[model samples]
Structures are given as C-alpha cells and as structure tokens.
Target chain A: MTIVLEKPAPARSGPGAPPPHDDTPARGARALRALGRLSRLTLTRSVVVLALFALWELAPRWELADRTFLPPFTEVAAAWWELALDGRLWENTEASLVRSGLGFGLAVLCAVPLGLLIGWYRPLADLLNPLLELFRNTAALALLPVFILLLGIGETSKVAIVLFACTWPILLNTVSAVRTVDPTLIRLARSMDLSAPRLLQKVVLPAALPTVFTGIRLAGGTAILVLVAAEMVGAKAGLGFLINSSQYNFAIPQMYAGIITISALGLLLNQLLLWAERRLTSWRPQPRG
Target chain B: MTAKINLRAVSKAFPARGGRESVLALDGLELDIGAGEFTVVVGPSGCGKSTLLDLLGGLDRPTSGEILLDGAPVTGPGLDRGIVFQQYALLPWRTAAGNVEFGLEATGTPRRERAALAREHLELVGLGGFEDRHPHELSGGMRQRVAIARSLAYDPGVLLMDEPFAALDAQTRESLQDELLRIWERTGKTIVFITHGIDEAVYLGGRVAVLTSRPGRIKDVVPVELGEARAAHADLRSSPEFALHRRQVWQLLHEEVDRAQELEREAVAR
Candidate 1:
C-alpha cells in the first residue's frame, strides 16, 4: 500500500572502463523518466479508487445509498474476512476452480488441434464452415437448458457448459492464426526444400503462436464468465452461488463481498495471461512511449 | 565449355481470370549463361523478368520448353540453387544467426556445425556481432544482409537474386552491391541477377540480357567490359565505361518500358 519514489543510483564507474550501467546514463535517465511517469499514473488511479471506496463506506452510513440494499464497504470487508476465516470462501473457490480448470484445459487441448487441422486442410475448413457459423451465432447460455437436460443437474452439466462457452474463441482464433501465417515464410521454407511436416513444425507453428495465445487468453476470460453464470443458475458451491444465496437471504454485505472477490479474481487472471504472453512472444517489439 | 544454365524456347502463359485474355508472359525465350559468370536480366515492369527467374529457380515450370542447370533438367527447387527475394523475408521471430541456421537445418547439418556456419555466414555478410538480434531489431539493410547470410549458409552453387537491392536506399544499396561483388569473387558462384535499374545491371553483370514487353524474350545481350575497372576502383560507377554500358542497357529497355506501360493502361481500361 506504500508508493516509494525511486532514488538516483550511486556512482559505480571505475578507472579503466566505465561500469556498463554508467556508460549508458542517458538510457538510465530515460528509463527513470518513464518510471516516474508510470508511478504518477498509478498514484492518480489509486486515488480515484480510494475516493470511490470512501464514498461507498460513508454514503450508506450517512443514509445516502440505503444500507439495506447497499451496506458500507467496511461491513462487506468484515463479511469477506469472516468467510475467509471460516474457510467458506476457500471451499467454494476450490469447487469453482476444479470445474473451471477442467473445462478450460479440455477446451484448449481439443480446440487447438482441431483448429490447426482445419486450417491446414482447406476441405476440412469448408466442411466445418457452416457449422462454425451456426455455433458462432448461437450463444453458449442459450444452450444451458439443453445441457442440463442432457447431462443432468450435476458437475458434468456445469463443466460441459463452461467447455462449450470457452471453445469458440480458442478454436476460431487458432484457425485464423494458422491461416494468416506469412506466405513469404512458407515460400522460404519450400525454397529450402523443407518437407511438409517440417515446414509446419518450424515456420507456421511459431508464426501462428502469438495469435493462438490471444485466443487462449480470450477463452480464459469466457471460462470464468460462463462458469459463474452456470453456477448462479444451478450449483451447491461457487462464488456465484454465494452471491445468489446472500441476495436471497438479504445479506447485502456478503453479496458485495462475493462480487468484490470475483472482480479481484478477474484482475488476477488477466495479469497471469499477460505474463504468459510476454514470456512466449518475447521476440515482438514492445510498444514504446 | 558447357553452359552453367540453358533455356531453350522457354515460354510461360498465365491462365486468364475475370474475362481477360490468357497472358503469355514469356515466349520463345532462349539464353545460355556460362559457368562462374555474373548474368543480369533487365527489363521494364510486366516484361516477365520475374517469370524467367522463376523458371530458372525451378519454382515454376515453363509452359513450353526447357531450363537446364549444369546439363540437368530443372525440376523443382533444390539446395543447389539459392534464391534471395526482394523483400528480405527474414523470419521476424528468429535471430540473425537463427535465420541463417534455417537452410542448414533443412539440409540436416548437425547442431554444432549449423551454429558455426551460421556465425561464419553472418560475418561474411558483415553481421557478425548482430547474431542474437531479431529481424525487427535490425534496419532494412541489415535485415537483407541476414537474408543473404541465410541463403548462403547451405553453400548453394548458383545464387538467383530477384531485385534484392531494390528496396534499399542508394548509399546502402551501393555498399551492399560492392559487398555482394566481393562475396561473388571470393566464392566464385555463378549468379543470375534480375533488376530493372540500368546502373545495377551494368555494375553487377558481365553480360546484361534485356527482355521485351509482355511475351518477353531476349532483346539483346550487352557485354560489359568494366569488370577490371569495377574491381580496381571504388568509383567505377562514375567512370566513362560505366556510363557507356548504362546508356546501352537504358536504350534497349526504353521502348519496352513504354510498351509495358501501355499494356498496363489497356488492362486497366478493360
């Protein structure tokens, strides 16, 4: 919660040769300037968030937003702390994790390979085009009743719903990724007399990877979204279930706690995916200020 | 001595699309390029210069006639012929050394040897210290150097370049042209270069072949006698002999350039 302004580095250059960092003082100064700007931006953002939180806490206490509908932020925090100590939050989170993880993992495994095959073979793409168009048009939530009827109101139904929801983004993105590989690179491989499999393995796969990763990240977002919706409709344990139950029982603070947790989890997921993207596609030039 | 390459009555006809006539790009083209000689093909745009290079590179088949490389019929792209495309198609994800290693890997060269050869070729193209830098990190000229290194890594006997320096600025292009000449001298590989620039044709090639418009065929072969002067002097481009050769090639291409422009207008009109 503390923001410390960075201090200038001590002189470290020696007699014969200047220290590597000291040799590039201009670059260091530029980086420091950028860092200063970034810190300022973060400070401003945090101030706005803090102001919003203060309003949330004070407005209800002052009878401004109605305490029955919107409890003070302090009360919601206390409720969240209670859930954490009692292990209720952990238990529900564990259940949700297992369901979401299985669905996401299965979607990635199935969709990537299927997409690559479809992209490589034009006839297969043609065969699936109509089906893809249909599925793309149809929303995953629209099929909830169908899934519940087919798979029954169990873990299978919820996980299946999550999988269906997550598949399209990963699948379609991968197909486009493969198709949009640079033709020049393909020609270069062919000119070297590379075998078909070898060409795909080396040139096409690496070239398509950044786009495919984008699809997976999008799918990751949808997995949580659809799983929450499914759980809200029918589930014994999950963040969504907690929120829904809290609302029914008129525990406004607990409901707010659940929503806050979901928002925090979403931020965590986005950060994790961004870190993975940076590691995988390090060759791409980073956007400069 | 047997010719390094022979093209006999070579012709290419691209199938018409969208209600246009079938385009015969090259017709009855005949040429013989000698072993260890630098040959330049020069013509106006749409004169089937690229089609002729494609035939020689075995990337495409002639609609009729034959292309023989060292007495063997040109069948398909093979390791014996290395091609340098104009755009400097270096894989952006790979380091300069890694790009050079591609052809070596395709030839199944061992990992250690591939690394060593990649470094050697990078140095040959004056990119020794830039081994770890990716294509995007390098300038356009540097990227082309990496591309040239990649093509040369597997040691192809004949180098076929398609306007490789066309994309570079004047200074970089001239320096690279000099570097290319040095490499050609040191390696003694037969080179078939394609370009539309009269100066580039005269400066690079011992024999320059000018092609006619549309159904392209050899208009004339201008023999450049400035090979000694080119090697001896840095300012061979400013020499009288260089000017004479440039004028000869320019005059041959002037009529073809107009005809090609006319053909383009007709197509646009249609």
Candidate 2:
C-alpha cells in the first residue's frame, strides 16, 4: 500500500506580511493533515516489519541452504499457532504474570515507608544509604541458588528473587522524590501552622509524587526481567520454561515463538506503566517552550 | 485595640564560614505595629526587610531581643501570623479549596466548617468558581490569589507578606495589589509587608520603614498618609501625593541602594 505524508506548515508572517485569516475550514484541514501524518508513520513501520518476515521465510532455503539451524518465518508462525491452540501458552503466561504482580506489590509496600523515612530524616538517610547501595549492587540472579536452598524450589523462591530485583529502584526513586520537593512549599506549610504529621501529609507527599512514580515505572521493568530469570531456574509452566525446554529438544521454531511471546509481554507491561504515569501526573503543568 | 507586636532591641546575627563573621540582618530593631495598621518595610536587597518579617511571623527567633505579640513573647510558627511568600507556594496536588482547607484542618478547625471557610476565602479572592482547580491549572496571578486565600482562611492576627507580588507581571501585580488593599480594608487585620519596590511600598503602606544596607539598621519610618485605602480611581504612581512619597522614600534609599550594589558585586566576587 502507498502512504501519503503530511506537509509541514508555513512559517508565521513577519511585520510586512498579510493579515491572519479567519477561515474555519483551514483549521479543520490542518487537523486532517496531522491525522494523515500519524497514519503514514504507522504504515511505514508495519511495511518494513512485513518485508523482513518475508525475507526470513525464503532466504535460508533459497540462498545459504542452512535449513538445519535456520527456521522459516512460516514455521515459526505455525509453532506459535500450535502453542496458542493447545492451552499451554495461556497457563505459562499466567504463571509469569502472577509472580511478577505479587513481587511488585510486596516491593511497593516495603519501599514506600522506607523511602519516606529516609527522605524525611537526613541523618537516617546517610546511615542507611551505604547498605542500600550494597544490597542493590548484588545481582538478583546470583542469589537464586541461596533462595532455592532456603525456601525450597517452589513459588516463594521465585517471587522472592523478583521482589529483591524490583525494590531498589522504587526505594531510591522515592527518596530522591521526597528530597527534591520545593523547600518553599515546606515553609508555606509551616507558616500555615500545620502540625508535623499534617505538614508531611499536606505538603511533602503530594510534591514528591511525580518523582516517586518514576521509580515505580523503573521497578516494573526490573520485575519483568527478574521474573523471566526466576521462572527459567525451577519453574514448570512459564514462557521462560518453554524456551528452556525447546532449546533442549532442538525445537528451533518453538524457541522463536516463546521468545516473541515474552517480548510482547514486556512491551505490554511498559505501555501499562506509561498509561498510569500519564493519569497520575495529570495535575502537573504542561511544559512551555 | 489589640496589644499588637512590640520588638525590643532585636538583633539577629548569623555565623559565616571563616571565624564568627556575623551578618547583622537586623540591628537592635525596635518597632511597634499598632492594631489594624498596614505597615510596609522597604529597603535595598539584603537589607533584612525579609528577616524582620520572618521575626514577626515567628518563623525565626530574634538573636538578642524580644518579639512580643499581644503582650506574649513570640515562639515557634503559630497560626496567629500568616505569611505569603514571593513565590506562590501552593501544594501541587491539592485543589485551590483543598489548600485552604489544609490550613484550617491543621489548626483543628472543625471538619464541617472547613468547606464553608474555604469557599468564603476563595470568594473573597475572586476565585469562588475555581475552588476545584489545582495550582497548575490556574494562571500565575490566580495561583497567588489562591495562596493569599489559603493564608487568610485561618484568620491570623498579623499578616506577613514578603514581596508577595514581586513575581507577577506588572499588570497582574497592580491588580493583585488592588485586591490586597480591598481585602485589608474588609478584614482590618494588621499587615507587615516587605518589598524592594518603592512604588509598591508607597501605594500599600500606612507607614513605610526604610532600612540601610548590610548591618541593616532602620533609616527612617515615614508615614505614607495617602489614606488607609486609596480610592478606586486614584492613579498608583501618578498624581502629586504618590510621587511626593515616592521621591521621599527614594531620597532616603538612593545612597543605600548604591552601597547595596557595591556589596552585591563584592559578594559575587568573593
């Protein structure tokens, strides 16, 4: 399909230029041009992806003849269709999501209070900062064996790993958020004769929200990363486990299908977090040029 | 009439980095604000006009003397003194009414009474219809009005303003100044306003206290006598009386302004 792009608008008139027009139809035409621009961008992106898939389906057989290692795009699609129809894919997807959701929820509960305390008291923040940094630096994947030995090879160990991976981002972001709130707002609250608790509630928390939300967004991505790894270690039903099983069986098409599904899941999670961020920060003023 | 504030030999000093370098923000400052007086403090920058306001509001304690409000020594921040900052420091998440309500709720105002008080104060500031709007949604002038409303909602005995209109555009600042005068007349609360703008001090103050630079001592306390509240049609900086007071205050501040500029350059260099 052919795609048509929108034309950029002309520069504004200088001192000697014509008087501005009052035509309503011209405004509507400009809006239509913007819509046309959006659709053309979307069309170009899809066409490029489609062309790549077409090349992948025929290239190995026609050119290199590397059929043993390279799987055709149609074969990969067939493998995806089989997984979807057999009900195993749905169960595996649900397992991964459940672990990620539970772990993220736990991390939020712990990080928020710790962050508030650290952010509020300078002395406390100095004391705990080093310990937090040390803990955050230790890799989540490296501790999987310890967790499995301690909690046994069940849901707890996997969920624990996910929580550990996600908590640091939320805590650090929350502390920064609280610390960076306008000092003027704090003084205003004091001038109002707000009690200590009331001042924190009325002034401190609200001002820190936009920054705190950034941490939550980062933690969402980290949760997904940790979940996939945790699921691959000892999990029975998950996209990660499917990838591991397919690799052992030399089911190359099935491996590609599992990887594609995992990527799509991660993309969906990122979009959801972005949507929430937009909604929560609706009160913030739009930046001017 | 209420006892009003009495400052007795108040001198505030702060230590600097190299050996007890004291900044005499206020030097043996003694002044009495009569009940319901609209007093404006004017000076060059860093002359401690703001420091004086902070003392009156009980946000900062005097280093060597006393600040007595209604015959009692002022202590920590209290609801009896309301302050409006130059920056319209509104809580970002709260609606206009919510910000007003926060002040009331903090001082243990009844829950049922807060909504009514919030609405009334907002209406006084000509923002009755904008009660539900957040600070970000309003224009700069409107947000400052909301801040004024939030400050006044608690009905403090003394209103301390530290160049509250300095951040607005000229038109908006003039309009808000007019609104402030109307509010002052309506409420008849004691006001201590601090500003570097000569015209603003002359226009708003019943009396103007001009300060010298650095070791900020009060140079002169001149009565404005442009009436307690200007007539609605009176020109702000125009006419004979306004210019007369403006000239008087300028003459007193001119030399100090030069000294302040020199000090500013020295500070920047250091």
Candidate 3:
C-alpha cells in the first residue's frame, strides 16, 4: 500500500537569477521529467476506473447476474447514446437543471435578506425563532402532499418543495454567521463613527459572506435532493422522471443512465459553487492544516 | 491651553448575571490630558483599563459623571477619536489600504482622496509597498502598523490605543514604540494609550497614569522627564530617568495587583 504523491517542480529561478541553458538536450530532459511526474499523478486513478468499467462489462456476459435486470455497461452506454441522439437526455437534463436553479435562486433571494435582518436585530430573531424551528423540523418531504394539493402537480409544486427544503440551511447559517462576527471588529467600526447602514455594508456583510456561502453551498445540495424527490412524485421530463419511468417499464439500462446523469449534474453544480466561493473570498487566509 | 480631555468623577458599572449586584469597573475617576500630550495608562489585570479606554473612545459610556472632549461632552463614537485595538481589528476582507480608508469612507470622503490619504498614512507608518496586502497576509507587527495608519488616516484629534503593541514580540514592540513616538511628534495629536507593561508606559508616555484595582481610579500620574530627543536615542530605555519612571509605575501597580488577586480569591471562596 505505497502512496505516491505528486510534487510540483521547485521554483529556483527569480528575476535576478541567471537564465537556464536553452539547449535542446536540457529542454528535452525537462519535458521528460514533467511527463513522468504527470503520469505518476494520474495513471493510478485512470487504471482503477478502467478496471472497474471492464469488470462491469464482463460480469453480465459471464452470467453473474440476470441480463434483463442488470444489463452490461455496454448496454447502458448504448441506451444513453440513443437518448442523447433523440435529444431526450438533453431535454430532461435541462428540465431538472431549470427547476433546481429556480428553486435555489428563490431560496437565496428570500432567505439572505431575512437572515441578515434576523441576525442583526435581536427582537426580530426572538419573535421568529420558535416559528422557524417548528417549520424547519417538519420534514420537507412530508409537505409534498400539501404542496401538491395547494399548488397542483405542475412545476410549481415541485419547485416549491425544493424551495422549502433549501431555505433553512441558507437562512440559519447566515443568521449564525452574522451573530458570531468578531465583536472587536464591530467596536473598531463604531470607533470610526460608521452609520448603521454603512456598518452593515462595510463590516457585517463582508465578515459574514464566507459563512453565508457555506449555507448557499449546502442549499444547492438540498435543492437537488428535493428536486429529484419531487420530480419522482409527479413530473414528465427530468432525470428523476426518466429514472422512475424506466424502472416502471423494466428498462434497467435507461434507469442506470438517468442515475449517472443526475450524479454528473450534482458534481458539476458543486464544482461551480466552489469556484464562486473561492473567487468571492480570495482575501480570506487559507487554513493551515 | 485648554485640556484635550477632562474626565470628571467618571464611573462605570456592569450588571452581573443572575440578578447579582452590579460590578463597578471604574469609580469616580478624575483626570485631564493636555492637548498634544502622550498619556499612557498602566494598571493591574482586571482593573478596567480597557473599560477606561472604551469610555474615552466613546465606544462605551460612564454610568455617572461626564467625559468632556475639548469643551463639549463626549456623547457616542465620533470621528473626533480614532482607536487602535490590541487585536489589530482590521477587517479581514479589506486590503491594508482599504482598512486605512475605512474611516475616511465613513466620513464621506471622495474615493480618490481616500486612496491618496490612505497611501500617505500607510507610508507614514512605514507600510509603503504593502498597500494591497490583506491583514492575514501581514505579520502581527505589520498589522498593528496598518491599524496605526488607519487611525491616523481619519485625522482624529485624539488617538485612543488599547494596548496596541501588547501582542508583539519584544523586539517588534520596541521598534513600534519608537515609530509611535515619531508619529506622535510629527502629528502632535493627543494620545491616550493603555498598557500593562510599566516599561512600555514609561517609554511612550509624557505622563503615565497608574490605576488601582477593580473599581479602577487613578492612583498616581508620574511625569516622564526623558528629553524630547528620546525617540532618536536608542538607549533611552536603559537610561536612568526611564528606569526611575518604570519603577515608580511598578510600585503603584504592585499594590493594586495584590489587592485585585485577594478580591478574586475571596469571591471564589464565597
């Protein structure tokens, strides 16, 4: 169980340092070294992934499982290709994405300002705390029937369910973040005689942004989870609906394809949120492990 | 000249938990700081040194009596006073220059002028070429320097520094003290500094006010007779006058510290 780690090349040269030799042999040696490092970094993971795929492809053919219920990797790939060619995969993906985006956006739009207000004003927080706790504790999925009854079985109910599920994390995390801001910083701001609005703008908001982003990232994951569950209950054209329909019709290969598509979409959304978090909090010091 | 600050029978009390009797932090403290003077306050731990600075900075109010600035009563926090906190309370999200520009921005200074003034003050504090760096990127000493720059940039008449260099290394503390002396000389602003270190108080203050234990009040105000060229004299700390002043402050603080410890023990026993 030897672990090989990739280390970047040491940076020895600076502006005042002498230039390195530009001969072909030296350049060729440097290129070879970089190539070796790259392979050491990526080759092991690639081999493991390929081996897994090969095992999946071979298991069905070897009669390890019933082919109708557990089709080979190739069959799933072929079904996915067919769906893509007919535009069903793209349409379904777009539908799921739009629902999650709208629900998540609505949650952020409502929760953030409310959270800031609740966090900043103690009276408001005291008034809202018990009610918010009650609603948050009530499982979002259990409200599915109620939402459908009131909002109907169309996109509204599905999006509304997601909005309900996603709002808590963003709201609660923001409130805690604002409340826990360093008191010394607030005193410093006060010493400057900053007006109430200016204090919120210059100190409170920026101080709490990193924690607020954490809430948003959590909400993103919740939105996807709730969206998929809601779509399964009643929807025509999302990854969740695709999986449900395929399972009912005994199209195991299509069901696997739908599951993989949802996983891929979740991964992409998380990465995008992480990128935004990094850009916005560039001034924050990196935590030392 | 009229005093820059006049504290008349100032007292502060905090409500204790569980409906207990209030704890007195400061008690009928009367003092006056002349304009353009450097006044250092030294006291035992838990002597409400910070509470005193908070009142003077207008971050907190005295429960009784009045604190007058120039001829007017101190109300709330205002642009007239600038504070440098011990924790270097620079906003982590802002760059060095941005932190210095904070008070100016609050006072509604134009963006262009704020930048120019921030740059000037940062240079004054010897933080030139480090304007874009964030507080976390800089060392503790550098962060304090930036905080000083921030306080100065606001152009306040009085600078209230609450043990600004207490967290720095000994060498860093010495250099910063010298830097502060130079700045005070150049700016001629009234400075009220709080410190636990007697040496630091003696080195920096033209007048050192020694405070008593809990329910703090001024015990003695010792004048530092070290010459005007003390900042340039590297050996000032080792000079006889400096040591004498340090000992005087230590003697006053020693009794107060013992009293505070005894009070704590009795409280715990109870």
Candidate 4:
C-alpha cells in the first residue's frame, strides 16, 4: 500500500491551472485497486497472527510439551465448542458480565459527580486529597480479603472489589480533567456573563469529557481485572471460576477456553468504550499526530 | 453627552505570592472613551493594558477607583460589554456558529434567533460557510475571526479587545485589522482595543492612548487625523502620515519599554 501510494509523478502545476479532478476510473479497476491496497496493508499482520496460532496448534501434537499440561489450540477450540453447545460457557459469561456491569456502573455513578465537586471546590479538594490518595495508593486486590471478611464471600464482596478497583481511575482522572480546563475558556465564559452552573454545564464539563472518557476506558479494564479475580474467590459460576476449577481438575483445554473468553470480553468492552468516546467528542478535531 | 466609559483614578494591584511585596499593575489610570469612539491602547509589555480592558469590561474591579459605563458604576461582568481575548478563547467543543451564539445563549435568546444572529455575525467576519467547523478545525486566523464574531453577536454597546490579532501572521493580522476597523465603523460600537504594536494602534484607532510601564498610567493620548482616506485607502499603512503616527506612538512606547526593563532588572536583583 505504501509503495503504491507513495509513487508520485503526476504534476498538474501552474497558476490558475485547475486541479486534476479525474474521477472516471472504471468500477472494476477501482475495486481491484482497493482490494490490492487492503491485502498489502493487512496480509503481513494476518500472517504473523496465524503463524502463532499454527505454532500453538502444532507444538503439543509434536510432543514438544506434555499434551495434558499444554493442550493444542485444536483441543481448546473443541472444548470451547462443547461448552458452547451445552450453554455452560454462555451462562458463566453472562454471570460475569452482569457483575462487571453493575460494579462499573455504580463506580461511574458515584465517582463523576464527586470528582466534579472536589475539582471545582478547592476546599473540598484540600479536605479529600489526603484520604483519596491513601485509598488510591492501597492496591485494590490487597483489599479483597478485607472485603470478603466484611461483606462475605458472595456477590456483594465480588462487586465491591470491582467497584473499589474501578472508582479511583475514573475519579482521579475526572478531578484532574475538571481542574485543568483552559483558564482562558473560563475567563471567556465569565466575560460573557455566564453564571457558575451554566459555565460548568457548557464549558467545563464538555472540555473535561475527553479526559473523563480516557479515565472511563482505564476503569473498564480495571473492572474486568478485579471482576475475574473476585470471581476466583469462592465463586461457583463465572469465567474466572471456570478457569480456576478447570486447572484443579486438569482440564487444560477448558482452562485455555476460559482464558480466551475473558480476553475477548475485555477487548469487546474496550472497543465499546472507544466508540462511546468517539461519539461524545465528535466536535474535537481529529488528532494531528 | 457623557462618555460611554469613564475610568476615574482606576488602579489595580495583585497580592504577591511567597514573601514578595504586592505588585501594583495599574496606578491611578484615568481615561474616558466617548460613545462610538474607537480607542486603541499601546504600551510596553506588562503595562496593564489588559488590566485596563478588564476593568472597563467589569471583569475585574479597580483597587482604589471607579469605572463607569455611561452614568452607572461598573460593578461586574454584564451583557452590555463584550470582550475578545488574544488567545481566541472559543470553546473547543463548540462549532464556529455555536461559539458565536454563546453570549446569546447566556442572555436567553431564543434558539432560532440565536442561530440567525450567529450566522449573520459569522458572515460579517467572512466565515459564513465555515459555521459548522470546530475551532480546532480552523486556522488560527479563522478561529480569531470566530472569536470576533462571538463578541459581536451579542450586540454589546462596548467591545473590549486585548491584542486580538497578535497571534496571526502579518498578512492575516493586516487583513483582520482592516476587518475590525470596518466592523467598528459599521456597528458604531465603542471599542477599546489594546495592543503592543504602534503601527496597529495607528491603523485601527482615531485616538491612541500610550501607557507607561508598571505601575502603568496614561502617558499620552495621540489623536490620529488620517481622515477618511485612512479607512478607504489600502495603501494608507505605507503613507507618510501613517509613518508619522506610528513613529510618534513608538517614541512614547520606547521610553516605557526602557523603564519596564529597568524595573524588571531591579526586581531580579532584589
């Protein structure tokens, strides 16, 4: 694609000369050109990924490692198919997704408004800074045992851990985002006689949104991480529990399937958040670099 | 008839950070701008030209004096005065038209009316078709044009501008200066524009007020008598009368620049 696109020789230069506006290429030629460009761009990347999968599939079969411990990619796919046919994988995935959704939703609900207030009001920020810092510094996973102790090894404790893990990124990012809005923008708003609430609604919030969405994306990853870990602790039905039990029972193929499902879920969630961010900030100029 | 804006003994001070003494930005600065007059202020950097505009715009209060709009004491930022900042402070999240409509929105103008006014102002600034473009999408000159449109859309009696063209390229700056003069004449709005450029002051205003170094005070008010030719003649900037006015303003500003440098050196030494 680069080779084809970079070749430049068609010069139509002169003062008052019209730009070359030929758009009369045949349909077949245009389609072939697009296909050639697509293959040039994507073929190498696809080859590399497929080579890794081929290695995974062939390694154990050639007795390069113990098949029982290191199952071939085919075995994992077979296990995934079996689980899907019986609906067990879907059930576990649905359970995990629901828990993640609830926890992340709660975190966003509480954190954004709190962050805005703390950022906007200096006195509140000063009062909360030390406490928030202490909590944020404490590893969220480290608090899992305490959460289990206080709330018990149930859905409550699992959701609480996810909430705890997700809240800080969203809150801290939002606080900084609100605090660092362009001072000139605020001055302009004030010059226009925009009241405090109107200024926040119209200028501060929108300006902070791109940063806030960044925080949300980070929190989305954190939520999934914490959710899986929490599910591993005394959970009966979840992707994390499936992986944990499969390993104990020597079901290596099933374990790999669970791991793949978790990673795929995370990727899907990240993409969704990215789409939301793009929609919300469409007014922003496309990034130059 | 009363002046549109009256600044009587206006002074502004900023409290020092750390253990340093408080700095006086403006000291007993007095000036009067008549209704529909175009007044340009030129001074050394940090001569409180912006501070003067802020006081007149009612965005900042004078420390020990009064600023009056017409007969009323200026209290706070109001809809009657519009300000165009040097940074072209249009909201990045808003399109050109939305930014132009900001003041109208604040004043509770109906949506349809605001849209029409915004479009009209955008057209006036030669940005008619670019109304939907965001600030980041526009060039610096275009963004400043949108800022000018935003300031004008609300129909303010007084327009206060602080070096609105300082960031643009020379060509863009000259063209924008011409556009601003045309707008000022057509709207008949009392304008107090601040700049560090002596030539810009001579080109834009009927009267140029040269300010001293901090604590800044009005050093001289030079009336420009370029007549109608100044506005109508494209070659007026290169004309001898224009040079004379530019040189006169530069001469007053040169002394203040030296004074400002000396003050800066003393502060650094202290």
Provide the clashing-pair count of each candidate structure.
0, 0, 0, 0
Candidate 3: tens digits of C-alpha lDDT, residues A106-179: 99999988898899999999999998899889989999999999999999998898888889999999899999
Better of 2 and 3 by lDDT: 3
lDDT string, candidate 3, B52-163, tens digits: 9999988888999999999799999999999999999999999999999998887889999999999999999999999999998999999999999999997999999999
Model 4 lDDT per residue over A1-289, tens place: 1233333324568878765545434444665676787787688668997898899999899999888888899889999999999999999999999889999999999998888888989899999999999999999999999999999998999888988888999999999999999999989989888878888888888999999998899999999999998888889999999999999998899999999999999999999998899889988766631
- Candidate 3 error regions (>4 Å): A1-39, A43-52, A287-289, B228-233
Mark the regions of model 4 whose C-alpha exceeds 4 Å error after superposition: A1-23, A26-30, B231-233
- For each candidate, what is chain B's TM-score? 0.97, 0.95, 0.97, 0.96
* Backbone clashes in model 3, listed as residue pairs: none
Which digits, one per residue and each the tens of the lDDT, describe model 2 over residues B1-270? 555988889889877668567667889887888989999999999998888887887778889999998899988889998889888888777899998887888778898899999999999999989999998789999989998998899999889999999989999999999899999999999999999999999999999999999878888998997762255435756867888899999999999999999999999998
Interface RMSD values, listed in order for every candidate? 0.9, 1.4, 0.9, 1.0
Best to worst by DockQ, what's the order? 3, 4, 1, 2
Sorted by TM-score (best first), the order is: 4, 3, 1, 2
**Reference-based TM-score of each model:** 0.92, 0.88, 0.93, 0.93
- lDDT (C-alpha, whole model) for all candidates: 0.89, 0.85, 0.90, 0.89
The candidates' DockQ values read: 0.72, 0.57, 0.87, 0.75
Error of 3 at A126 (Å): 2.6
Locate the minimum summed-lDDT window of 10 residues in model 1 chain A: A1-10
- Summarize candidate 2's per-residue lDDT along A261-286 as a digit string, tens digits: 98889889888987787677777765
lDDT sort, best first? 3, 4, 1, 2
Q: How far out, in Å, is residue B240 in model 3?
A: 1.2
lDDT of 1 by residue, A21-80 (tens): 644677667668878878888898799889999999999999998898999999999999
